[model samples]
Target: MHATEALRRLLEHCPELDRTHDLVRQFASMLDARDAAPLPDWLDHLAVSRLPALDGLAKAIREDQHAVVQGITTPFNSGVNEGRITDLKLQKRIMAGRAGVPLLRHRVILMAGLRRSYP
Candidate 1:
């Protein structure tokens, strides 16, 4: 299902969760409406306050300058790394679930390193 619809379903199912989910759904709807255009002024302001480094980096990019913007606009994400770990777990499960902790740790580390080096 599309992200907006999925989010709507989730909100419908859990009406008492944190409000951030609703905000996210609204943001997604805005993006869909605008074809994922640049964030609107209000959203930009909110982002700037919440993430100063991103605001600074955006300013620099606007001025045709580049600099290390750590803590803002991370160059990589841990999602792929987490996925790799999950995949490793599944593979180990197929092998009678007998992989030792050390071997699993080594395999995950090696795979993460390789992914970073190649990707």
Candidate 2:
């Protein structure tokens, strides 16, 4: 059976999976059948309607790629690192920053080790 037909059968039996599987199956069939059957009129209309949003997304991706290539954007999870830094800042404030860096480092290390040992 064609991929589309198999997908239709699967979707009919398991509607809970949503349309993602059907879309993937349809895309694969489209790639394999190159110049085979044309898409239905409804799908063509939907694609036209979504073209602008897709183009914007493509543009954003290109800009992001350029930034990465130019070293303008650091490849790091700033959000996660910032959260850790914020926790460190809170620790410093609680101790009024009176603990030297070494003592602070030792405290953090001990806390992490205790968490791991207990957890």
Candidate 3:
């Protein structure tokens, strides 16, 4: 495809982009595999890659290194809780100026019960 050819030419012209792309792929694979073993080495490489954006990400991850490692190694996650919060926010927006807090609370509780029933 045209996009593929363009990307190939771009990577050929910019070796740094090629390196960054490989690093990004590696990081994605780590997340998919739920493995943190390579994280520290990856962070070190990213920091010295001279790429400002990736360097900033490395710095932020280093700050929360423990949480990151735990998240990677554990099966438990905040996904369900986050989904409920998102649903609550959307419901709030939809009902804004149209209903009272009592109505909103009732609807959220109903929805939560429905989710439990189906899931």
Ten residues in sequence with the least summed lDDT for candidate 1: 65-74
- Which candidate leads the pack in TM-score? 3
Q: What lDDT does the true structure give each of the candidates?
A: 0.57, 0.55, 0.91
| Model 1 spans > 4 angstroms off | 1-78
The sequence of per-residue lDDT tens digits that candidate 3 reaches over residues 1-119 is 69999999999999899989899898888889999999999999999999999899999999999999998888899989998898788888888758788998888898899889998
At residue 102, what lDDT does model 3 achieve? Answer: 94
The residue pairs in collision within model 1 are: none
Residue-by-residue lDDT tens digits, candidate 1, 22-111: 445655665445433333443454345445554564566445422222212344457675889786886577657678878877777876
lDDT of 2 by residue, 6-119 (tens): 877887887544344544455456545542243343244334444555345445545564442333223333655575576577778889979899988877776566656975
Q: What TM-score, to 2 decimals, does candidate 2 have? A: 0.29
For candidate 1, the lDDT comes to 0.57
Question: In angstroms, what RMSD does candidate 1 have relative to the true structure?
Answer: 10.5
Candidate 3 stretches with Cα past 4 Å from truth are 2-6, 83-119
| RMSD, every candidate, angstroms | 10.5, 12.5, 5.1
Q: Worst lDDT window (10 residues) for model 2?
A: 68-77
Cα miss at 87, model 2 (Å)? 1.8
